[model samples]
Target: ARKNGRVGIVTLAKRPWLTESARIFLPGLDLEKLLDELQIPVFYAFEHVSRRVASFGTPNSYVAAKRNAMSECLAQLFGEAKQCSSAMSIGDSEIELLAIQELMSELAMSRFSTPLESPLQFCKTVLLRENPSLVQLQRQIESLANSLGSLVDHPGDLSLELGTGRRLRLRNHLGPNLR
Candidate 1:
């Protein structure tokens, strides 16, 4: 209701109805104390099997995400329900993420090496630069080049779409002669 430019606001009074299994503690949540600690407008939360995870959000999306995340966290923690693999967690969540492999293997009805199939490899900037051997560097460079080429092609026919809509002209940002 305030003139803040945001999709929505989740007030503390109406926040509890977001999830089924997650319990929120309001009296325990000292808003002023938290703001003093974090130095940010952190106000909302989702939950795990135990603990409160608080942060700010865009009401509807936040509440929806909190519901989904709490559900998955409860599932994973209790080993009863399924974890939402794609759910991203904030530092405030106080929840530990079991590797995707663990969740996939546990939920699989048939025996298949899903984890082995999708091994996550992170090449940090420093690691990809000053940290590898010559052969490793070359391999990484080739991989990077391939990724660049994939993005170089147009995502959609931009010319075809704009041609029929109206007369179009390019701005002279590329230098007056080029434009």
Candidate 2:
């Protein structure tokens, strides 16, 4: 299909037997690496299928789930014009390009109805702010551990003073060997 200038998409089930089959057929070949080299995108049917559709026991429901998963994969493929172009030749048809743009816009709006901050962005915002108490506590723990010296064989200095004026010490009542 690729040699004939047609895009080939593969949909696979999420199962261990696929790997076993690949091992038997190809013998030491990296299936994923081969797929990458061929520029073939592989979509796992179960990954894209919604939980609700997947939960249904009917054969029709199973078909619907597979269809839904395929729809998502196709949408993702066609959603970006550059990606679509790289995958296969869409030519310079203005109408097709305009349609793709419209589809992408629709997909974006449908997927994200409400504005949301990504977890990474939220984490960056949180990390940028300084927390003095946490820093102090961390420093105190480090200091305490340092004061204790090598805790492997023998116990060194057993007492330490924290920055908060609290005294921390290993109990002497436990005797010399403190495992």
Candidate 3:
């Protein structure tokens, strides 16, 4: 720690027992080089302590401290993994939707048959905004609304869960085209 609260001097010796996997993953991580690049005045904390006269920690203590740090790091990594998975799923759904939309547009344009002059026909054309993809997505969403809605709403009280715990329930909210 420093009086100005910017940085403190510290020295770290590389653990010789670092695994091959770690070396492979962090091939370019040179701690000394990093410290040098930072240009911070750093020093080893144990420089004044006589190594031969002092044995401060046991292997268990070291393991526990490392474990705590590793757990926090793993938590961050898992969060990133979840985010990446969600993004990937959304991207995949978008690609599929685009493909379906293209197919529907081609089918709609290819057909030259005259649409019947009925209220239902006119309503669909208006409601769907003349986009076949939108119409298809709407139908899929409406079809799932009943079944999925029941699962989300409490069977007895019909109360809804309002947090991230209800994420699965919102799966239908993404719409049928996304699924």
Top candidate, metric lDDT? 2
| Pairs in clash, predicted candidate 3 | none
For candidate 3, give the lDDT of residue 51.
Answer: 53
Model 1, 96-127: lDDT tens digits are: 12222233324332223453443221110101
- Displacement of residue 13 (Cα, Å) in model 1 is 12
lDDT of 3 by residue, 1-179 (tens): 11211222222223332333346766877655654565433333233234542245543333333323322322343442112111101111222223223322322333323222111100000011123365665664464444443432322112122221332322222223223
Instruction: Summing lDDT over every window of 10 consecutive residues in candidate 2, give the lowest-scoring window.
Output: 118-127
Candidate 1: pairs in clash: 44-55
* Residue 122 Cα positional deviation in candidate 1, in Å, after optimal superposition: 9.6
> TM-scores for all candidates?
0.19, 0.38, 0.20
Write the candidate numbers in order of decreasing lDDT: 2, 1, 3
TM-score of model 2 (CA atoms): 0.38
Off by over 4 Å in 1: 1-85, 96-111, 119-179
Task: Assess the local accuracy of residue 166 in candidate 2 as a C-alpha lDDT between 0 and 100.
Answer: 47
Q: For each candidate, how many residue pairs have backbone atoms clashing (under 3 Å)? A: 1, 0, 0
Weakest ten-residue segment in model 1 by summed lDDT: 1-10
Better of 1 and 2 by TM-score: 2
